[model samples]
Target: MLSSVAAPSALLPGASPVPVHEASAERDRQWWRSSVIYQIYPRSFRDLHGDGIGDLPGITAEIPALAELDIDAIWLSPFYKSPQKDAGYDVADYCSVDPIFGTLEDFDALVATAKKHGIRVIVDLVPNHCSDQHALFQAALAAPENSPARDMFIFRDGTGENGENPPNNWQSHFGGPAWTRITNPDGTPGQWYLHLFDSTQPDFNWDNPAVHQEFERILRFWLDRGVGGFRVDVAHALIKKSGLPDWGGRADGASIEGFPGHEAPMFGQAGIHDIYRSWRKILEDYDGDRVLCAEATIDPLDRLTDWVRSDEMHQAFNFAYLHHPWDAGDLRSTIEASLKAFDKVGAPTTWVLSNHDVVRHVSRFGLTGGHARSGDGLGPEDNQPDHVLGQARARAASLLMLGLPGGVYLYQGEELGLPDHTALDHGHRQDPTFHRTNGERLGRDGCRVPLPWTADAPSFGFSSTGKAWLPQPEEWRGLARNLQALEPASTLSLYRTALRLRRELSLGHGSLAWWPEYDAEGVVAFLNNGVLVVMNMGTSSVELPAGELLVSSAPEAGRDGFLAPDTAVWLRLA
Candidate 1:
């Protein structure tokens, strides 16, 4: 599906579309209300210790670079102690930093340094489950059946003549059965425990009071360390339906809406809201408008809003907008629905284009031009990505995302316009997803490859000892941060400029109104804080709205009146 773009076919511009509204005064609220938070996948960011892995200290060393980008906060992926199973998603300890990542002292220093630079830190919280090596889980494993330690997790009796089968038909998010049979101390077949993800990560029984109390203590422990908020991992999967029902053989375990089993008993249960409500209270007790942002994939955009209610989470990642195809109509519909839904609960909408889990949008937008479908970890056997085309579209997509009202998150390497390492070798793969699916689904390691800092430096300067946990491709040398910083037109420069203007124009904290001037099949135009944003997603160049050009994602600003296809521009209206 990675093909060349079609020739442009110009179409006559029609009358005004939706009317623009005046800018609102909401920009003066808390920093989070309109903040732009950059997500840092700790493992792939940088490695200062030269141990071939990124650490908290390495991230602290990069704070000045992040500050220069004008971001208000940083959402760090899990850095807690873990067994490295599921790439740190399987946490062994919530209160301490992993030895590989750093110690608690290193974490304290990082937070202190980040605070000095006026950047807030939002930590990733894995409340749904913990690694089997965790103290609580270990105690549960050794304790007798029905002990309080075991009660904290979802351990249940198995079915079948010899009790060899799992408790239910639920599937793991990584692929395969969700339940793993455990053995008793007597060396006999025993009960099974649920793990929505990898087998090493056991799902906590949220129904248990001890589980709730433990999480509350975990929240306070981090809050005491000065974290501004949390990015809740698998926020929807924490609370499952009371009955562990059959999944009906559907494979899309992450999604709760589609497939034959629409109401999957594993995730997006109604009780999840109560958990957020309690966490929200903990955040309020601390200073600063500490927030909770959910990584929820609940469908029907409106229901997704429930996670961001007044008493629940402050923001929920808008995956609907992130997953929308590059078609203008689809994007416009998602934007409209997101605004309307979030507005109902007085919560700011959070927009994100890429994260550690999904295929990078740069490569994603390349295949099929606009309606592409590329899975993560695509190797040599898969269709190659059009990096040039992908980079161009990715730049435009950034401007469009930043210009909208509310918060936005920029993934680690997106500023460098890094496309997924589509040809990663199978032996280097680490995501449990790849193993669980037996290489049938290549996991998310391609996007998680370590960042490139210096073009010619060993390991792209990601590690001083000349090795990276994941190999960096030679093609990435040209896209390194140092090289991009010198090029004014580079994707990094575009993001720096866009983020600066997003604040100067008060776009993030303002209201959005559909531009009434132009409405074409594959074009979307919106006005926020007197700035008119126009994007041409169609095969043809569209007329740019009249205004002084502030910034254009295209190499050159539209001459005469037309914007090139796949380009986006911000116009400062008179």
Candidate 2:
């Protein structure tokens, strides 16, 4: 049984109201296809160490809280040994843990404890590239230009008369030339290597047999250590088009992400599918239901489905849906397109609204209050967000996303309704994109700020030492987890109830049938099994179809069956 829709309750003076949730009924083995996975950007989650940076131990300590959320799995961002150049995306060693994050023992304990709590763990795998300081990259620098170690990366001789120019006119996703010239061992000018992102993070030559073999070993090493799956970072980017041709003005004016630039030679090349097919075999060889989820930014819904066919990866992030504006028509089209495309190959569509790289959806939805951006992301320099309106929309969006028939991903602080720290100072910014663009563009640091856990604790209970790598805004105190947990009308409570009801109703694993007869112009109403999910995206209140009201995103009595604007409700169909 699930909790019923009730009026919003006043917050208790010093108590946190944790909801009681029923366990979901057991289902098929391919649970990854429809499970709700929570993503933890480890650095911003919690810091067990006084050093002010989050660690694996901090994540381990929070497993109980995570288990309370009733999420089926947890996807931890990169915690591998790194130079912090790209904030852990730049992997120095895939098999080892960064000292800052803690020892390998801590990660093992996290996996063990999470399993004990009936939660699966998915680790981030960065096989597309490695930190320039990686052992292989160092060996490449020491070996000769045409040596086998140099072949491990995308190294090529310059093309100009004096070999002074780069191999091509390729530009880095971060900014500047994608190719970086290196000095030879003899201190003479040397060949250049390619890096789609920052120069410190060199790209691997997927064409190289050694690169393929190394990633296979890396995957097996983690799987053997009890990780249930791997979330392949930049999954669509490993295999670039042959000959590295120019983008031909396809670059979207320095934007790092968007559909317009996905067609360029740098992303979604055909060969990437073959790699996933091979990886699928590795996942199958394991005893348990190990899975692979791609962080693919591929476009064309049909092409995106290719990565999730029966023999390829189990799931890929539905980025197109995430980038859709907060309009009913666009949202409906995106949802329909995603479900149709994935259904073609019998793959589950993975719905995600926010992640580590993009602007938080709460802020994105509030863009109309003068925070609009023509691109995928909005920065601190953008107009101020209407927090009240953003929170309303975010709450409604959660119900709509969770009611869909597939897997969903929840970024750490989204359940708290944390908007982007849009007032972050430029000098405190750390994302490589921000520095690479000379601060003209504020990168993703605003969304990556550490979360506030307690309203009165030091560093908002994120760390005991009251230190944080990125500062938390003063406003976060009111939105802290401890405070929200005590408020029945809080966003955190709404998420708790929604996730619990999502499982209790078996809403995650089903087919969606839209009821246009019950839907208004700006409304979306769908039926799944005996449940009807109605969302009012329009300005005015709309009449809901006759059914027993189970829950809603807003706190209001059923007034003549009217659903409030920006509200979503689940009704028990007769």
Candidate 3:
């Protein structure tokens, strides 16, 4: 039932993450694997208290609209109690609300609300570390010699070898050393611990038994609270090279960032799998599939399969599509490769066109005109899709991703065809990393902007207060929710139609039949069941055999609905 093809865009001669989707699992497994997932970055979603920051309450309010989109689940970014460092990725407490997001009662209500609407809630679990200000870490550091808490974290003595010799050359993902030199108010000799990301966040020593118990409790805490699953943050980094030695500085001008000046090679270390095995056992205790999607993309195709093998994770993301260049050859080969790999591993795949981590697809591909910020190498003309000739070709990408053999991940606002706004002054930017780097990193704060739900309403009805968190979608009020929803030809209307078709027909879980030449430079074709799906990438009309048209990204018949440029059409082949 699924289309299988060779791997796409290989750099190394060897194949990666072979596809291993099990044919015997319920179609729903693959459905979710292929289901459409909508990601919600809470801090920028909505403000229930008008506090200039988004909250769970705001996301709660928007659930109805998402449900209408027929989305399978909402991948909510961390809403757990945190100091807000790295925007909720740093947990201060595993079981409580951060007060700013509201109380435990509120989260419970949100979980209840989502389930009542048949929606699943997936929270961000940053088990790789905890906030330095966390009570346990404080207690451990306060009474290391005598505190049982001391064993909870990774603490050690160094030979006072001066700053030149670090315990290891571990680099922080944000900018420096994975370890920090900290002395109590007493100015004691410093101890070392791993922190793969920001210094404020420290990596948990998963090799320790205490680390296992704490994480298990954290996992069960959310599951007991009605949360369906978690998206493991840097999940692959949990294990290290073990009893590590110094990697020395690269000396090539690339000192590990954020960290003092080194790189952490703990990634994909052998010990990590044991940690995953332990975590998997804990997850299995839950009543249902407790999704454990990893933030792994180093070797996506191979990594995906490794993480989601029968004994590992239930699903992994398909970032290849996101990273691939937008052309027929790449798209065709990638999809075919993905299908083949899934088949090999008996695992499922999820397609995320956009998320809070990277540039928006529309922006990345320069699919939307009037915005030249994305680095897709397009001229001013390329941004502007030729309306009559390019609409179908453009819409084809969505159809292909949604109709593929696995899950689909959709970002909020994409349902409304919102375009990126490159209107930020240095002073207006809020991303800590972007601000720290002076614009070198895109920091994902732009796509994290506020969503435009109701046009005629105040602040697009996303918040009831003044100066909402993150900027509101500029000029969206005119093409606002109510207005676009009222007009059938509007982009919102198209989204509605597409979602409805997807949900009503159980589109995502089905097998994909990508055209034999999925890599065709001008068109991306596939057979979904009995229907033929075509997306024309060229500037001229492309013809399909005479058949009944199911849906068209553009209006009018293409000779027989010849299809327009940058648009798509689906038909039932005679």
| Each model's lDDT | 0.84, 0.83, 0.66
User: Model 1: clashing residue pairs?
Assistant: 16-516, 17-516
Worst 10 residues of 1 by lDDT: 1-10
lDDT of 3 at 305: 69
Q: What is the C-alpha lDDT profile of model 2 across 1-574, one tens digit per residue?
A: 2334333322224533221111233433578867999999999999999788999999999999888788999999999999999999999999999999999999999999999999999999998889999999999999997889999999988998989999888887777889999998788999999998899999999998899999999999999999999999988889888888766544322124452555578787888889999999998899879999998776778878888989999999998988887778788778888887887887888899999988898887776765445433455567877888888888889888988878999999999999999888877888888788786667788889999999999999999999999999999999999999999988898899889888887778766777665333688777765677777888887765556677788887233477787888887753
Compute the lDDT for candidate 2.
Answer: 0.83
Query: Which candidate order results from sorting by TM-score in descending order?
Result: 1, 2, 3
User: For every model shown, what is its TM-score relative to the native structure?
Assistant: 0.94, 0.93, 0.85
Better of 1 and 2 by lDDT: 1
Q: How do the candidates rank by lDDT, highest first?
A: 1, 2, 3
Q: What TM-score quantifies how close candidate 2 is to the native fold?
A: 0.93
Residue 175, model 1: Cα distance from true site in angstroms: 1.2
